[model samples]
Target: MNILEVNNLNKYFRQPTEFHVLKDLNFNVEKGKLTSITGKSGSGKSTLLYLLSTMDTDFDGSINISENEIKGKDNNWLANFRNEHIGFIFQFHFLLPEFSVFDNVMLPALKLGKLSKEEIENNAFELLCLLDVADQGKKKASLLSGGEQQRVAIARALINQPTLIIGDEPTGNLDSQNTAIVLDLFKELCKEKGQTILTVTHDEDFADRSDRIIHLKDGRIVT
Candidate 1:
């Protein structure tokens, strides 16, 4: 089944005299698959992702995720929807330096408040272990190495068991070995555990290894 559907999507930036960032895009992302979006620096990959994540509401189009249409939603509604249904992993490990790795992982679930604190803690730890970062759970986020920190970020993203995980150059900061590890983890998550993922990356190897790749050029999908 399709987990996400986008139709007639368009985005514009007026700050520099009205430049279109995404142009009439249409696509569907199936459940339990890892899809990658690839493009050059100005090809609107990141802009499209933000729209897909519902964090940029200034677009004109229909974005349906898990059967819910996100167009026209207020910021408050969008924020709640995002927390519950979508997880995000960015190039930078955006963890709170003062918080422990475990706490960073549990933060989102705590904000979500759908499960008990104990259950959330358990889930957080389990995710860390799954990502091979369980031993670093008690350490402050700043203490972990770059690769370890990224793994922790991945664990945090999975803590809520989101319907979809959105990644923006998730492995950009990792070494080659760590990049391979993350790609394999994504494959396992999709093929074995049935997770849906969409990522935007410049890493050729990463894009090539994904279940599917969508090429964008000059704000439009290309064949």
Candidate 2:
């Protein structure tokens, strides 16, 4: 089954005139597949992730998730859908410095108010354990190492049990060893849990681990 479908997607930024970022991009990601989107700096890889995650709405064309078109969904519904069905990991960890690692992971569940406090804590702890960071859960995010912090972010992203997990340069900040560790974790999760993932990266090593690679040049697919 296809989990995501983007057809003839076109996104333009208007500075003075229209400058296109994505041009007639079309792609489909199947359920339980780990896919990579790779391109140069000026390419629309991150923009595509934002659009797929419903964080950016300034675009033209159709994006369907489970047969529901994104264009027909209201902002309120889209926000809810993203929170409930999608998990995001950006290059920056985006963890609140003042919060404990556990709290940061549980933040999504807290904001949605769908899970009870006890349930949220339980889920958060389980995710932390899964990521091998259970012992650091009580520590402040600011105290953890770069890799530890990224793992915490991953745990938090998984807290909601999202079917689609999107990561933009998630391992960009890590060293070679840490990068391998994190990449392996994502690979294991995708296989063991049957989660669909769409990741954007410039790292060839990281991109090679994916089941399929989508290469982009100047905002268009080249391979």
Candidate 3:
């Protein structure tokens, strides 16, 4: 089944002129699949991601995530929906520098308030363990090495058990060993937990290894 569906998507930037960034895009992301979006610079890969993640409402299209249309929702509605249904990881870990690794992972679930505090704590620790960073949970997020920090970030993203995980060059900053760790983690999420992932990446090997790659050029899918 499709966890995400996009149809007739179009995005434009206005200022100098009405320049279109994404044009008539259409796609579906299958549940339990790891999909990558690949493109050259200015090909609207990131722009398309922003729209799919419901961060940019200025675009024209129908985007249905988890079977609900997100086109007309307000920021407040979108924010709440996103917190519950979508998880995000960026090139930078984006963990709070001063927060402990455990706290950083628990923040989203704490805000969600769907689970008991004890349950959230258990899940947070479990995720950290799953990500192989349980030992670092007590330290400040900034104190860990880059790979450790990224693992913590992934743990944070999974704490909420989002319907879909979206990543923007999640391994962009990592060394080869760390990159392999993350790539393996993504595969594990899909095969073991039946999670769906959609990531935008410049890493050719990463794209090639994914279940599928959506290649874009001139704001349109060329492959």
Candidate 4:
């Protein structure tokens, strides 16, 4: 089953003329597979991720997630859809420096108002434990090491149990040892939960671990 499908996708930004970030891109991610999108800098990899996740809507063509079309959809509905179905992990971790790691992870569940307090806490704790960072839950996210911080970010992303996990350079800041640890964790989680992951990374080692790799070149798939 295809968890995500993008067809003839085109995204352009207006500069002096027009900056074409993605041009007629087509791709699909099957369920329970780890897919990597690799490209050089400024090749629209992150732009593609943002577009698929509904973070940027200024584009053309279709992006279908689980049979639901993204283009031409209502903005409000798309926002809600992303909140309920997509989990994002960015390079920066994007954690609230002031909030405890537990609270950071619980924020999305609380905002969606879908999970009970007990359930939300349980899920958050479980994720942290799975990542081996449970003891840091009460501490501010800023206090954790780069690897630990990203681990917490991963846990926060999974709190909603999103079907599609989109990661953008998630291990970019980590050292070799930390990178290996995080990469192993990602692979283990996908198999353990049967989840789909689509990640954009320049790390060849990380890309090698994915089930499928879609290479991008100047906004198009290179095959």
What do the candidate models score in CA lDDT, each in turn? 0.93, 0.90, 0.94, 0.90
- Residue pairs clashing in model 4 are none
Comparing 1 and 2 on lDDT, the stronger one: 1
Query: Which residue window of length 10 is worst by lDDT in model 1?
Result: 151-160
Q: For residues 1-223, could you state the per-residue lDDT of candidate 3 as single tens digits?
A: 9999999999999979999999999999999999999999999999999988999888888999999999889999999999999999999999999999999999999999999999999999899889989999899998999999999999888989999999999999999899999999999999999999999999999999999899999999988
* TM-scores vs. true structure, each candidate: 0.97, 0.95, 0.98, 0.96
Please write out the lDDT profile of model 4 over residues 1-223, one tens digit for every residue: 9999989999999978888889998888999888999999888888898898887877998989989888787889988898889999888999999999999999999999997999999999999999999999999988999999999999988999898999998888899998999888888877888888889999999999989999988998997
How much is the lDDT of residue 193 in candidate 1?
81
Clashes of each: 0, 0, 0, 0
* Comparison by TM-score, 2 against 3, better one: 3
Off by over 4 Å in 1: none
Q: Which ranges of candidate 3 are over 4 A from the true structure?
A: none
